[model samples]
Target: MKNLKIDREKVLLGVAGPVLALVVAFLLTALVLIVSGYNPFEPFELMFGAIGEQDVQVLIINQTGVYYLAALAVAIGFRMNLFNIGVDGQYRLAAMLSAVVGAHFSPPGFLHIVLIVVTAMLVGSFWAGIAGVLKVTRGVNEVVSTIMLNYIATSLIAWLTLKDQFGYQAEGSNDLTTGEISKSGWFPGIHVSDLAGDIYGFIFVAAGVGVVYWYVLTRTRFGFDLRASGASESAAAASGVDSKRMVLTAMLASGAVAGLAGMPVLLGQTHTYSQSFPTGVGFTGITIALLGRNSPVGIAFAALLMAFIEKSASQLSYATPPYPPEIADIMKGLIVLSVVISYELVRRYGLKRQQSRVGRELAAQAAKNRKEVSA
Candidate 1:
């Protein structure tokens, strides 16, 4: 009974923080909408309605896979106390190069897809490894180095994608692309319905990544060392873990995952990297990682929630009073802020409860001892 009670409490405490944060975020967002003279409730109603639409559901699922991969990448870095802000640049560069390779290859069977994915992972790891090297060797902060690397990567991509370079301009299109991959290189997706469109096949790969992430973190020795180092570098070092090596490993792993973030869209939909390839997803991954508390399961839910919000928000512009689509951005920001505050509060409360329980147990034992001695 006691064990069961403790387990129940643990479960409740685990869920309370996120639930409290979300509730507070919604209330605060409502306040903002009221102050702006718009019906916040109406926007939420519309968004909820969108959840029932098949097409929107398909979009949310597709986007969730992308967001999940990105968040996992961020979570890997978080495990080792590294901030890999350059995931944006790393994935973009990886996708660009991988697209180039995919465009040139006409390998038979699944080899083409495998080649593109491996190329992306290698490129991303290499790009992110630079920051790790600087941090370990020169004591440069990963944050600063990664940020600088992002700028460099952006410039490099822009130059490489120029029409005269690896990129080419199609006859009728204004956008520059790495040239379309042959049909053999394209990823096959699951067709839902005519109205719903095809679901990204890479979703399975994302799910596999999450499973691997969970297993590695909770059941592996390397994961133990990585977590220990993140918790306290000196303590971890005393325990025989090499903190520098862990940092580099974590960054590389994170980058490798980030490299896959763009693969779903590129192979399943775009079939090429263009001047208009998605950006800022790496930054969004940071937000999702924090929201998910760095857990694989938690991250999955957070990614789904985020994707749902983004997809549903697109309908606001077509509403009767037409709320601005930016409202979703505001709500996301508020949720993130609320999550930080609520989690801290929950942590403190849980600590106090445990301390109180321990004190009560100690006092009860003391009282029993005195009674026995008196008898």
Candidate 2:
């Protein structure tokens, strides 16, 4: 009963942060709308109404999968006290190379897909490992190394996708692309309704990744070591945990997951890496990871919320008395800011509550001791 109560309290406290953030964000966004001579409630109404459309629903779910994967990648580094800011570079580079391989080869049925995914993971890990190696060997900060790597990766992709290189211009289109993968290599999608289109089959893969992430972090000795090292390297060292190795391992794991972020679109939809391929997902992952508090379940919800906001934002300019599409961007920015402030506030409040409880218990014990002495 005591344990259950403690767990319940922890859950409530955990939830309090995000809830407070959303409330504050919504209010702030409304104020902005009012100042801009727009109806704040109308935007919310339209956004909520957009959810009724089957196609929009499908888009949200599919995008959520991508966001979830990216956020998970970021969360992995966060858990190890490492800031892997290059997830964008890692995943983009992985996707491009993997797409090239998929285009060039067609193995057996499922084996083809497996090969592409494995290739992507390997590429992502390799890229991220550079930052990790630099951090451990040369005492480089991951933030600086990863940021530089992102630029390097971007330039590398641009070069590799040139017409004479691994890329080709499709007839009737000027956009450069890594030629399409064989149909056998394409991931199958789940059909729901004709209007809705197929949901990305890789969503299941994302879910599995989340389950694995939760299990590994909570159930394994390595997870404990990683967590301990993140909490305090000196304390972890005293406990015989190797901090450098853990940092490297975390980066590798993070990059591997980052590799999967683009597979949903590549295998399930586009079937190729092109100039139009999505970007900035890795940076968005950082926001989601922060908003999710680095938990799998929390990240899932955060991903959905972000996806919904993005999808809903697309219709703003087309609506009656159309609002600027930038409204959504404003809301997102406010939410991020609100989340940071709200979480800090909640932390301080919880700390004070805990301290008060401890003081009360001490006082009660002192009173009992005084009574015993008088007797």
Candidate 3:
């Protein structure tokens, strides 16, 4: 019971870290405002109003899917301590390939659309597998390899977009992109109240990810082995778990999910891929993973929180005083830094508490045994 109480206290402490960080960050911002001779309270007041505005809310909603998908990519790899910096390359290449497939195939209906989406996942997984295979076979450091691969993937996609063989050619056009996909291949939007439907659908998808990923990590034998391998390769190997195989599988799975981040942009918004695809999403995944502490549910909230800040930053700038847009980036950095440090602190504290509780319990048991023997 004492142990349980300590565990509960640790959990509360973990939860409090983020809240504490927020307060600290706000106070720091207030200090900055004072130094700058600006009214700190005024900006915050305007921020509150901007958040309540409809257009700003919609913008935030739209960003939910993008952040959720990107974060999932980094979180999966983080679970294994694999730094998948090539998420950008994998996601972009898969988006281009999937876009081409979607455009060329001209699927007739829903089933065909499903097939195309699945194909995208395969392409994404395959792309990521390249890095995983390199790591497993040659002992290549994923950080260096993934970063190098990002350049290669970017060049390859750029070349493909301009080449005639890949069907990216236009008769007399400078833009290097394939034609738009058929309407049937699109992910249909949903209607939630008076607002746009894409956000609602995205929220549902994010929730699904949380549920499925949680199950995959906790309930399955594969998850157990993956976690074991992540914790220690030597220990896992001694236990007969193939660390290499798990690494490869986890990387592939992570990339597949990252690829899905483009689904909203490809199937819903743009209905096609282009050379000027959104790039920072994969990198942002790293920050999201840190903020989320590698938990799927935590990632969802982190993503949403990030999306809200980004959305509001833009709208608030337009509505009130034109503060520097880079403020959003600064805040994101601070949040991620705070969360990572807080998570580590909480984890360490929890472990210490458990150890102390066990020691006390054993000591008490020993004393009781001694008394009984004397009697």
Candidate achieving the largest lDDT: 2
Q: What is the RMSD, in Å, between candidate 3 and the native fold over all Cα?
A: 2.7
What tens-digit string does per-residue lDDT give for candidate 2 at 194-237? 88899999999999999999999999999999899999999999
Residue 120 displacement (Å), model 1: 0.7
Count of steric clashes across candidates, in order: 0, 0, 1
Instruction: Give lDDT tens digits, candidate 1, residues 273-307.
Output: 98788888898898899888899999999999989
List clashing residue pairs in candidate 2: none
RMSD to the true structure for each prediction, in A, is 1.2, 1.0, 2.7
Candidate 1 ranges beyond 4 A from true positions? none
User: Highest TM-score among the candidates is held by which one?
Assistant: 2
lDDT (Cα atoms) of all candidates against the true structure: 0.93, 0.94, 0.77
Q: Estimate each model's TM-score.
A: 0.97, 0.98, 0.89
What's model 1's TM-score?
A: 0.97
Per-residue C-alpha lDDT of model 3 across residues 1-375, encoded as one tens digit per residue: 977986788678766766666666666666676687766676566666777777667667767777888788888887777999888888888888888888888756886567666776787788888899999999999899888988998888877776664646467876667678877887776644565334435456656876788899889999888888888989999999989999999999988987777777787677767767788788877777777677787777778788877777664466445666666777777776666677677778778977997899999999999999999
Task: Look at candidate 1 and tell me the lDDT of residue 175.
Answer: 88
Sorted on lDDT, best first, the list reads 2, 1, 3
Model 2: how far residue 60 lies from native, Å: 0.2
